[model samples]
Target: MLHVNSRTALLNNAAFSLDVPAKIENGTTYVPARVFAEAFGGTALWSEQERKATITIGLQQVFIHTEPHKHWRMSQERINVLNEKINEATDLSSYSQIRTHFRPYFTDSFINKIIYSNGIKNNAILTKKGRYYLQ
Candidate 1:
């Protein structure tokens, strides 16, 4: 179950605050596309040529048509922090920031599975650039 209040939402006891508020139209709730996607351990991609946005999670993918006239603010700070850390450090534990800020990402079951099954070994990961990431 999902619980939403204004710009904040909670799913599986993981809470997120978005820049935009959720909408209630006809008593139905609507959240931004990006916010909802990431909450479920998904990554979104936008294509200029196709005017579409795609969210990928595990082996599943969802596509949404984007309209040029409409304005949407998408925030990727959650992913950005993880990427920046992985890019800069040889170990995930080397991340200097407070862990609570990144709790959602770290505690995500899907990401843990990926880390444990594919990208990580012996508390280390080899990035595509051949850099070592320590857990």
Candidate 2:
């Protein structure tokens, strides 16, 4: 959790310092993506060319576009297409297959990181409430 205008954050009961403090702008609380990702045992990659930040945790990935005007201008149809592509690519079993399918949507380095990471677990169990628990 982060306190407004503070550079200090609390994660799992431990205090961590942030390079950029959390702030409330236009009634929206914005925290540093890098710090948040690291706190959650994830990785955040920033692309200068794209003005985007990609945060990856386990099998979940989030993309944040920093440019305010561009984000508002993004079309829902484009988002749906990208989501469909991601859903289709994730259904593949082999690393090669996944890499091939995701090449168009993701950078080669990002794909390599995901494929080589030791975070993937095969012992996940489906709980009664329909949530997955890593064993």
Candidate 3:
């Protein structure tokens, strides 16, 4: 676990010291960009001019703003909600019910990864409207 105003992170009962201290504000814990990014097997590219960080892991990449912004915050909230919905679904039928619901939040590869990784079948039946049904 990581706490605010601390330079240490505890994992598996062992504490690892951080070069930059972690900070918490409004219940949000903020850590160093590069360190946080590397922990997730990603490389973080800090853009001083753009004031943002680009984290790339494998073929996936995400952009994070250095400072908080309202629009991005809303988008993140939506993503959190979509993730919750996806996790709650247990079967292909139920998952397909919300296909369009999370379309804006996930890419084809991401959805494919989630379904395949969960041991779900990939053979989905398609309809004329482009919706999927479990075969």
**Best of the candidates, TM-score:** 2
Judged by whole-model lDDT over C-alpha atoms, candidate 3 comes out at: 0.63
Per-residue lDDT over 11-75 for candidate 1, one digit per residue giving the tens place of the 0 to 100 score: 77778676677777788998777776787788878799999989888789999997666544424
Model 3 lDDT tens row, 1-135: 777777788755778887778887688877776667667777888788898889888888889886644332334445455545555533555554455654666676766665666623343432223222222
User: Model 1 scores what on Cα lDDT?
Assistant: 0.61
Q: List per-prediction Cα lDDT, in the order shown.
A: 0.61, 0.70, 0.63
lDDT (Cα) of model 2:
0.70
For each candidate, what TM-score against the reference? 0.39, 0.43, 0.37
Candidate achieving higher lDDT, 1 or 2: 2
Clashing pairs in 1: 90-134, 91-134
Clashes of 3: 0
Best of the candidates, lDDT: 2
Clashing pairs in 3: none
